[model samples]
Target: MKALLPTGDPREPVVLADVPEPTPRPDEALVKVEAFSVNRGETFKLEAPAPGDRPGKDVAGLVVQPAADGSGPNGIARVVGHPMAGGWAEYAAVPTDALAVLPDGVSALQAAALPLAGLTALRLLRTAGPVLGRRVLLTGASGGVGHYVTELAAAAGAEVTAVTRDAERGARLIELGAAAVVHDLADAPGPYDLVLESTGGPSLATALAKTARRGTLIWFGQASRRPATLDFFAFFDGPESAVIRHFHYLDADTSLGDDLAALVRLTAGGRLHPEIGRIADWADTATVLTDLRERRIRGKAVLTLA
Candidate 1:
């Protein structure tokens, strides 16, 4: 099997090489990977390559074999899965819990874009509790997770204020459901009832200060890669009762299959739109990774297996 492996080289971090095929466990299904999505976090991992580490986490494909436990979809069904690694290959062994059958009308490219970003947005919204008629602030509103968060929050009746430096991407967010778009975090309206902060650095401080009293602000990622420094005194000036919560998608209360099914249903019903910013052959994975790392690509990037 041909797989993209970490080369541990600065100039060529990942190289496609012949690797041994994966053997599925009793509870796992062997998927013939048709497509996969690139994530920003995976780009960071490529910075320090490991010999056998397969970096891909999101994959969509045909289930060639069912789990021996007789769980999950069967009979060569189209499915999307969240594998820990080894997805950027010809096949991957996906755990039954992390797999969901893709419904009719949902293309492989769209399903490939759903797992990480879609699940993250869905779970974060779950953590946000009821959003109806609330003021929501979403920073870094142009990436894969950002697009889902913007649409989901806005659809739930929250007046979403999406912050992104790119005006072009901001315009798309409005179409997705964002009520207002700001070029910077400082420009965002204050006292938001719910906040999703991804870009770290000063943005984190601004998000904290703008959170409404008793409001919840979930900090997920640091796309900026800069560490955030906060003055303990600054908290005193902001809302005294504001809550700062750290969120990870894997820590969600719901099962991955359940959440993925929800997302699939939304996509099938023409509700949740999977924003695919880039689509290309899997051979172009290296270039796509560079584009994502430099923030050149918006939304999710999917690569198809040839």
Candidate 2:
């Protein structure tokens, strides 16, 4: 089997090389990866990768071998999975609990896009509580997770305000159900009941300031690769009842398989859209990683196994 590995070189950080096929445990299924998605966070680890560190999280494929424990999908089922690592390969050993059977009408490309970004958006909205008739602020609203957040939040009856520097992306966000689109954080209307913030740096402080009284701000990512410093005294004039919470998708209490299955069902039903920005053969994994690191691609980038 062939897998993408980190080369530890500044110019060429990743290379596709032949590797041994993975063996599944009793609680795991051996998947023949039809497609996979790359994420921004995964690209950061390639900067200084450890020995034998496999870089991939979102995997979608057919279960060639089911788990011996009789959990998850049965033999030869189409499924999407969230493995801790090593999903950028022709074959992956995915734990049954992390695997979700995909329904008809869901393509592998769409399924591949769902695991990480979809799960993060779903979990963040869950953390945001009921959003009906609420003013929701979404920062960095052009990427994969942001797309899902905008669509799902709007479907739940929340008035979504999407903030993105890209005018084209801003236009698409409105089509995806955002009530309003702003090019800058300063331009976004304040007093938001819930703020889903991912861009770090100064945007974090701005998002914090925009949170309404007794509202919630969920900080999920630092895509800007910069640190955010908040003026302690600034909060004195801000809403004292507002809450700021750091969130990671893995911290959610629900079953991973269940959450993924729900996302797949929504996609199958055409209620949820998995915005795939780029698609290419698995041989071009390095190029895809470069595009993701350089921020040339929007939404999710999916790689297919030829």
Candidate 3:
């Protein structure tokens, strides 16, 4: 099977190569991958190795063979989490418990883009508390996770305000259900019940300031490549409250199948829609990684196995 491997060198870590096919264990299913998407973690792993590791996490495909334990449903599965070693490949073996059946009306490419970003958005929204009739703010509203967050919040009856630097993308944000869109945090009206912060650095502080009193602020990503630092005094003295929380999609109690099921349902019912940036052949994995690293693409970039 052909796979993309990380070489541990920042400049040239991701490369396409022929690798041995994965063997499914008793509790795992062997999926003939149809599509997979890239995430920031994958890009970071390639740029800087944490001890020993490979990239690629999200996967959507058809199950060629079910686990010996028969854990998957109807012999079809969507795998996520654990950053399996062969996502950018022709086939991958994933735990049957970690797989979910793709929803009706959702394409393989779209299903591949949902696992990571959708789960993260769901978790963040849950952390933000009840959204009924509340105002929510979303930074990086044009990114993969942001789009899901925007739609979910709106569907929950929250008035969503999306922040984006690009006016063109801002329109798309509003179309996704945001009540309003702004070029920056400064331009957005404040006192939001919840703030979904995706970009770090200055945007984190900006999000904190706009949060309503006792509001929750969930910081999920640092796409700016800078650490978040805020003044404690300002945070404590402000009328709007703040809570900084990180969204880790792979927590021990998080069931991949359950999350994927929820996402699949939403997509199947037309409640959640993923905005895919580009779709390329699996062999072009390196090019996709490069585009992600350089921030040249928006939404999700997926690779479909030919």
Candidate 4:
């Protein structure tokens, strides 16, 4: 099997090399990977793995070897969730419990894009509770997870207000079902019932101020690479009560089946379309990661296994 390995050297270490194909455990399935998406977490993982290791978690592929456990509740099947490594390759073995069956009409590329960002968006939205007929704000509404969050929130009947820095992208957010779009945080209308904060740092603080009294603010991503600091007095001592919440999608206890199903439906129905910015061959994994780290790419960048 050919897999991309991260060299510890920060300057130039990522390279594709032939490696041993992973053997599926009794509870795992061997998948011939068709496609995978590059994410910030994946980029970070590439810089550091267990000595010599592959780095990628999102994958969309066909199951060639089902786990010996069979297709029972705990049986191995076409796995889709997290993998220890080897996602950026032609083959990977993943736990059956982590997999979600790809819907009939969804393509491998779209499936590859779903597991992480879609799961994160679904979990964050659920944590925000029902948004039906409520005013919701989503910051960084143009990135992978942010785009999914926008669509999910809008589909739930929330009057979604998408926040982005690019005016052109803001227009696309409206087409994605955002009730409105703004180019800057300063331009965002105030007092939203729920604010999904993806761009942390100053943007978080600004979004926090715009939240309504007793509103819930969910902080999910730190795109700015800066830690978010909240004003203690502004939150705890304010006349109107507000809650600042931080969410990590991987911590959600529920299975991804429901969210994956919903995302599939939305995509199939044309209500959700993942904006694919770039598609590169598996051998170019390192270059893609470098671009992602430098914030030189847009939307979701997918690596296809040749």
Order the candidates by lDDT, highest first: 2, 1, 3, 4
Q: How well is each residue in 1-306 modelled by candidate 3, as lDDT tens digits?
A: 777778777566677777788887888888888889988667776776665354567888888888888677545544442235667777788776667776458888778889788888887777777899998888888778888988898889999999888777778888888899988788888888788888899888888888888878877787887988888877876633567677765663667777787888888898888889889987777777788778777889988877
lDDT of 1 by residue, 183-247 (tens): 97998878988889999988899899998878888999998999998777776797677788999
Model 1 compared with the native: what TM-score? 0.98
Instruction: Tally clashes: model 1.
Output: 0
| Stretches of model 2 off by over 4 angstroms after superposition | none
Q: lDDT of all the models against the reference?
A: 0.91, 0.91, 0.78, 0.78
Between candidates 1 and 4, which one is better according to TM-score? 1
Where is the poorest 10-residue window by lDDT in model 2?
Answer: 232-241
By summed lDDT, which 10 consecutive residues of candidate 3 come out lowest? 74-83
Q: Tell me how many clashing residue pairs each candidate has.
A: 0, 0, 2, 1
RMSD of each: 1.0, 1.0, 2.2, 2.6
Best by lDDT: 2
Residue pairs that clash (backbone atoms under 3 angstroms), model 4:
80-99
- Residue runs of model 3 more than 4 Å from their true location after superposition: 9-13, 50-52, 74-84, 252-254
Model 4, 77-149: lDDT tens digits are 3334556566877788877766777656778887778778888888898888889999998988777887888
Please give the lDDT score at residue 123 for candidate 3: 74
Write down the TM-score of every candidate.
Answer: 0.98, 0.98, 0.92, 0.91
Clashes of 3: 2
